[model samples]
Target: MIKNVIVGIDPGTTTAIAILDIEGKLLYLHSKRDWKREEIIKAILSFGRPIIIATDVNPPPKSVEKLASSFGCKIFYPEISFSVLEKQELVKAFVYKAKNEHEIDALAACVKAWKRYRSFFTRVSYLLSKKDASELFEEVIKKLLKEGKENVESIVEKMTRKREEPEERVEKPKEKGEKVLEEKEKKLEQAKKELEILTRVLSKRKAELLTYKRIKLSLEELEKCRKELEELKRANNILKRFERIRMKKFEPLVELESINSLELEKLDKLLGLENRVVYCNSLSNANVLNNFGIRALVTECEEEINVANLEFPVIKIEKEFIQDVDGVKCVKEDKLESLLAEVRKSGLIKWLENYRKRKENY
Candidate 1:
């Protein structure tokens, strides 16, 4: 028997189809370009009998309406057209089954229809189980969709009574015929019991299938969270390394591009040259250093600057005494103090004698 199904269609140049059984389980998804009406009908019939035809839009396309008419199935469309984002979300869990946007939209429409009637289907299952007519699940569901709920209760009552009714007994003169009739009734009751058992088994399998789909979706989400956690761990490691570097003591040093009067004047105004160690490439402005309450000078001079009896020390540039911490150039305080001690040991630094000698030569 062809199982009852819901058929969702995307009717366009490239037509797409999605089929779901009455229990909302996915059955088939396909798309074909420029498919004729006859071919579409054939493809749908191959899967199962469609009890309802669904579309994503409120005012469904004429092609979809025609297909529903041809199949004599009920047409289902939402009150408001489903947006792209809504369609995407509806089918996100089953996205892997859809090969294209058309298939996704079709699946979304079918899923929406299933959700609308899912509660009603559950109630039908309950009522049928109460009446011991579980074997009438498919037939009753088909009628419930094609007909109405009120009619379904009466239909179920009639079907159950017909199955339970006993056959007529023959008179005692026809003993052989009576035996044959009794045997036939026994076999019929046994078949009904077997059919009910099969129906229950089918329902259980459908429930298991739904559980598997949910678990698959949960695993996908877990994978995404795992990747995000790894990224956060890597970022934290980098921050920790930077934190360690920041914990070290680093002395701030002001670097001058040139020793010209104007540049030094601007630097002194901006950063206050007082008690500030100034570094420069040349010592041409060494004579002006004492005007500011400068601590010392670090220069790349080949010869020492002989500022006439200047109290401030002049240290030559040493790569070992400099360190760059996070893009800011700084001097090593311990190394600078050791270099200053070595300079002071020479005794007054011979400042005046050297200045006078260099002046006379110039």
Candidate 2:
């Protein structure tokens, strides 16, 4: 007999009382400091039957319309405005994900101050229907400005009789004296081609005024050497901050002296060493301390590890001697000594135990 439809709320001092169920999910979200009128009529008499009470807290106070007319339910006011402040910020971000995110930011500032007090009758019925549609659009713009001033005075009296019939025609002074001597020889060949284009534009305006005075004296000597190199870089950054505050007040008296010995002469130069190896192999158990310090010895095979005398090679292994070597994947010597003690605790057995202690000290 599933019949429980409750949407009862009286949340004002800035709105909130949500109850929605007929599949509109949010079955209960109450606020106005958690209901009061007998816990909102015992949550609408425990939703046993009569429901539906959506009240964006409007003029609903004659004791909440006598408790929604003694609970027979049905009370829906819902017209808060400013688009209910984006539905009270999506109902205070989903009731601040179920409760107090600072009381859903103080119930979204009391539902934006109860939708600005129910937008004063929606702003006085939108300013009395915009003053009755602006006096019916100013009486249709004064009857289209009195029919555009009687069609602009009847097209200005028919363009004043075609301008007095082209000033009554006068002509023959002996055929205008040979058409005024061929229009004065065509105005003397257009004044001799405008005086040869004004003497080639005054010699290109005196060569662009001497290249605009040499680019305005090279932009005022590059703005006075950029203000004397910004005052010598602000006095060399205040003398490099007073020489870094006198080298931080004499850095512990120059790190307490002690520096005059000089004898560094071991120059068998491996020029800036980086994993170097050199071994012109006179194979005396060619270990080179099993691979970490040989820097040169190539009699040949060079291919550019900087050519001349190469010899790095020392990663040899060959011992736990079981030879089922054909693509060997055999394991058991107690799982190869627990996988070589987890590959010698992961430093890959320090270059195979320094190449088996340089082949057991040769």
Candidate 3:
């Protein structure tokens, strides 16, 4: 049998649920400080099947929405639900002494839903039995809201017509000969029951066979994945043709770039510089660079600006600096060109190889 009731919820740190019947009578109103969603659902359903579910807030709380959806009922919402102050005022007439805020909010929502639909409920009750009317109310209001009164009247008229129609039937008298065949029919029924048992056993075996096939296919898929992994490793090995001699061949360039010294020497211990590279729009970033104990690679200095007593090597470069690309700073195309121009051929080749190794590592 379809039960008819309304449910309201206030979901929060303290969860509360309120239920009302078709006649606007309270069925249940309770709260839990620590609540579980499943228990809320269970409690709402335990009261009676919901005809309408409601909540007091706009953007109704997710837990409240979920409970309403699970109930599969018409949900009611006032154009704008009351504010906290308004709820206390509205609930005062019906509920004088509420235990807490959650209970008051919940009951207030239920009262609002009842007030909104009471007139409609009264007219529906007059049209049909209360049981029949409430069963149809969820459907009726949805259509009435979407279409209009005319559609709702048509639906009522159709239901009345179904109720008024008389059922008709005809029966043939049984013969004595039919009684004679009953014994044979009983034996045939017994044979059919045995056949059904065999059919069920066959179905179980077929399901087992399918399970075996799926297991075999899964094993094959895993084997294919292992082979693909091996192929990838071999591909990596094939591509690294110069891995054996890159370091030894990279030695001479170290000298080509060595004379580039005394960029800074015998300076003050600016304990504020070690470990991180800092970028600056201008040489003015020198103060920030000195304040923090980290590496500083300044970008806007066209000519070297050597400040006295500055211990850190705040190298100024004329090129774009790429952040953390394969473990090197300033590895962009322009930076590579500036490096080649400064260090000449041997160093350039070694730098190029290091960049390639970094790219491969990435």
Instruction: List CA RMSD, all candidates.
Output: 34.7, 40.4, 34.0
Candidate 2, residue 167: the lDDT equals 79
Candidate 2 local lDDT, residue 321: 28
Q: Candidates 1 and 3: which is better by lDDT?
A: 1
Clashes of 3: 5
- Spell out the clash pairs found in candidate 3: 272-293, 273-293, 274-293, 274-294, 276-295
Candidate 1 local lDDT, 1-362, one digit each (tens): 66778999998999999999878889899998998999999988998888789999979999999899898877899999999999988898789999998999899999998888878777777888998888777677767667766666677787678868996875575888888889999999999999999999999999999999899899999989897677667545544543454467545556777667786775565456788777777676577777887888876667766655575878776676677776555666777777777767554455566778899999
Report the lDDT tens digits of candidate 3 across residue range 162-226.
65679664333464457657877998999999999999999999999999899989989989988
Give candidate 1 regions above 4 Å deviation: 129-135, 150-155, 162-362
Q: Which ranges of candidate 2 are over 4 A from the true structure?
A: 1-186, 200-206, 247-362
lDDT of each: 0.79, 0.42, 0.62
TM accuracy, model 2: 0.19
Residue 125 accuracy (lDDT) in model 1: 77
- Tell me, by TM-score, which candidate is best: 1
Distance from true location, Cα of 55 in model 2, Å = 99
